[model samples]
Target chain A: MEAAPPESAAPITPVLVAEHLERKLPGDPPVTLVTDIDLAIEPGKFTAIVGPSGCGKSSLLYLLGLIDRPTDGRLLLEGRDMMPLSGDERAQIRLRHFGFVFQFHFLLPEFTALDNVMMPIRRLGRLSLPGARERASDLLTSMGLGDKLHKPPDHLSGGERQRVAIARAMANNPLLVLGDEPTGNLDSTNSARVVELFRELAHEQGRAVVCVTHDPGIAEVADIRVSMLDGRICEVLRQT
Target chain B: MFPRLGLLLHIAAMHLLVRRRQTLVATSGVAVGVGFFLAVSALMVGSQTDFVKTLIAAAPHIIISDELRSPSPQPGVREYGKTGAVELHGYKVRNEVRGIKDWQQILREIDAMPGAIGSPSLSGAVTLRQGGRDEPLGVVGIDPTIETRVSTISEKLRAGRLIDLERVQGGVIIGEDLAERLGLGMGDIVAATSARGVSRSLRIVGLFKKGQSGLGSGTGYMLLREAQSLLGRPFVINRLGVKLPDPYTADAVAKQLEARHGYKAESWQERSADFLGLLLTRNVIMYTVVSAILLVASFGIYTAVSNSVTDKRRDIAIMRSMGFSQGDLQFVFVVEGMALAVAGVIAGWLFGFALMTVLGSLEFPIQGEVRHLPLDRSTRQYLIAAAASLFAGIFAAWLPARKTALVDPVDILRGAV
Candidate 1:
């Protein structure tokens, strides 16, 4: 716990970094999704990678999140090289230190909200049944979803489902939270609430968050914004 | 491992429950196939065993027939009539059989064979007169002390006492069906004519009814010496009743007797080959058809699993991206199929047992030497069917389960992404 940055620290060692990355789509006419890109995300920073359609913003985020491999690049997380680890080792890293919230909030339809949140912990195989349940309840309570513990995805509204997804991503106390258009499927009010939750998590909990979005309003609220175009990082801006 | 197993089981159960209709359709496919297999196999085995046991109870395991001589050959024709090769010339037809001069010697030789148990019996067509009515019947001479070794008729005595060895003068047991037809009762005296035209009055000491080969109904049993005396032969027998130590050993013993001695010995199975062959063939055909039922039911399982894969495409991709392996998904579907198969086998077994019980109580129609229906061996047949049903169900689900398990998670996700 002491290894984590304090809330008072304005900046610390960058937890995620990608340098000179390139990804090519193998097609009749090959398309380069990312090319010679360099980026870094500092701890406790609410950063958004924004770009137009067909830009490499999502690809760069996916590489930083350790969900996909870069064609020719170096990726480092917490000062450790991400390329030498096996797929299972990478998955363990994701399960332990990183949480992901996808565009669709892919909640298992058959499981209730509490069970969905408990899935990652259970998969870790380190906790007993009651221990996992307790952790799941605590996380849901922290996320202000205690009342919807037993509601299935279909029964829950889109906003509640997204909250459940967020709770699930944070179940293992991950250091970095990665969201890819998490509010893309929600309405304006729900989207604002989701962004507020992200801001609170980063500012109060002292956690790093990197979100990929095309929405300008979301980018405007971020402490740091990286704009990408044509598979290259065009500019980086900081809020005063 | 245990925790993973628990999680997998919970996940499988939830999926099955959520897709209740699909699960039911899959389970019912296996159950109905197994049910028909069990029912048909049980009935076939039961009927076949019943037929064989009933026939054995009424007859000996082995039968010996006296030799029959051919007519004298015509002059200037090199024609010899033999067992397999009979040459015919222009000669008058005549049959003159040599009497068994050394009857005691032959009986002793037959008894000396390994596992051979024999009793002398004399048979001939005779007219029996009782209460001013006459009926033609086949007369049999049996040694009372050893009669039970070959035939089960003694245990089926419905009225009066069985034949007594001490009463050597003359004692007879007549079938109940024959007794009824002749208006004869126990202890009634009936005059029986022998082949030599000699007549003797015999007491009906017992009456019996046989389920199969109702030769019991139209048969008369008397003392061996009495039959020989009535036929004007001092010591002669028309046939001998022979039984081996075990019913399955009859053929071996028969082969030995034929090789050692120049006498033709026939096992009961050979004597009733036509009937036994018919039953065995019917059983094979029926079992084949019932097993094929499962072959058809597997198609339903294939369709159900294929549909499930199609419906759960997105879920599969998410699971794969979350680190679930292909082997894991394989295990999931296997668990589903195994659950369905187990339920089907259990249900089919219970249903088969119930059917057997009902069949055991009901009377079947009489046909071609068989009167009673048998459900005694149904349990064993049901067990065989249950095993076959399970095997077929598992095999049927294999192809579909593999297809679903191996579908590229990345491809599925990319198509829908």
Candidate 2:
């Protein structure tokens, strides 16, 4: 895999948009996590969300992935309003359209790497067992994990586990992939390899990618950079 | 969305396999509960049915006697209108002789009713005197041929036969217990005095052993004519015993007979109502014990599954985030609980069968007969146990599962990471 900046014109329409989004914990003196947020995510690009600690970057990622609902404002996917959908409906949209990679890889310990990757695909129920197995195998092989298909998560290295998690997120061939500091636990060599993979996934694979990270290298290489502070985005920078 | 058995079992099997010991403990708890329930119910209900059977065979289902449930209304009250009636001052009720003079007609009417066999007999108190012993007895005068068909007396005779009551002059059949107590035997003659003042010399022709202790020592049987002569009430039979083919029809038949004839009629069921009520109470207590055992077993399942939910919180969150619906998650855990119950039920039925077999093999001597402890090894008890335990398992599993599935998974995933 090779990493290069896209030579194509950016699309005008965003695949997903959040308008004035806000989430608050309900209690005495309610604590607000994300507030008055507006953002657009486009296909075929890697958008890096960079913020300091305690800046609600992860909270915003949760809302964007529809893993968490905003207390206020609206979330839209493909120009369709998502605020009216039920929780199960949101889950269905997530299954069909979005994938997530957490900082810890979050692979089920009892399952083999292939089984872990095939979980979401199997739940989608659109494919037969052999078909799902083949799809999961192909995704893992593309991520250079073909030989470790049967290995449990505990037996794999941190980078390999993270790659397996990535393959799982992509098992359904989602339109967008989201990661929360996925390489935070990896060595520099592994981190650089993950960075190259994200770049190739955005450019060659023609998929939208978003990562919440403190890694400056990801910001330097991303197609767009979003900076946040105090639950609000303060700046947005684009690669001409 | 609810998952089918394939996915449900896949996850459930993995969870159970991972915690084999805990699952086994839960299953064993249910199995023990089920086993004991089957064994205890079989024994208790078996005894109840056996006791009723004994009662049905021991006496006539209905007895019509020369008695009144209530006194006849005063003649003065029956005669005049209330406004014109005068009360009698210092009046005394007349002493009336108690005998069923129309017993023959009543017996024929009863015998004509479908499935009823009526035996005309006299019941009176008599005192018997031997060389050095005297015993007070309740003597029942029966026509041997008809009485034997109505009662189990033929099977209870230890010496001679009921027909001997007719073969000998003034013949009497005493229970062996009474004869043994008096040191008397067949062919011995004894003087019997009536409750009034009449007396007669009677010869012993038969001896019966009840095999049960209650009435053996005080009961004697004789020919109807001999008892009437000894009791000084010749030509009058005081009781008409009606035996029914189906003992369960006793109550209705007794009621119908009493309404037709103005005599006090009593069914054996009514006579033994208190005992049958006690049996019903015993059954309630037995089932309560059964429920207690299974309730405690259900707690074990609840604890096992609850602990699993707490321990697998992260895994649950991951699966929830993977788009498994709440129903789907609940299905996995519920299946695990029911699987434990199913295993327990099978194992428990085997254990119970063995226990019943062991109990059924046990024999004890009562009076003169050796009898095995009664055990109702009916299939219904197994089915009841299975239904009860499975329901308990499902309930136990459902509570904790709902708690885990309905919670906001974001919180669990957040806590884990």
Residue pairs clashing, model 1:
none
lDDT of 2 at B24: 92
Error of 2 at B185 (Å): 2.3
Compared with the true structure, what per-residue lDDT tens digits does model 2 show for residues B215-243?
55788999998888888888898898899
After superposing candidate 2 on the true structure, give the runs of residues whose Cα lies further than 4 Å from its correct spot.
Answer: A1-12, B1-5, B72-96, B191-201, B210-214, B405-407, B415-417
Q: Considering chain A alone, what is the TM-score of candidate 2?
A: 0.94
Q: Give the DockQ-based CAPRI class for model 1.
A: acceptable
CA error at residue B221 for candidate 2, angstroms: 1.2
How accurate locally is residue A159 in candidate 2, as Cα lDDT from 0 to 100?
96
Which number leads on DockQ? 2
- TM-score for every candidate vs. truth? 0.80, 0.91
lDDT of each: 0.74, 0.86
Worst 10 residues of 1 chain B by lDDT: B68-77
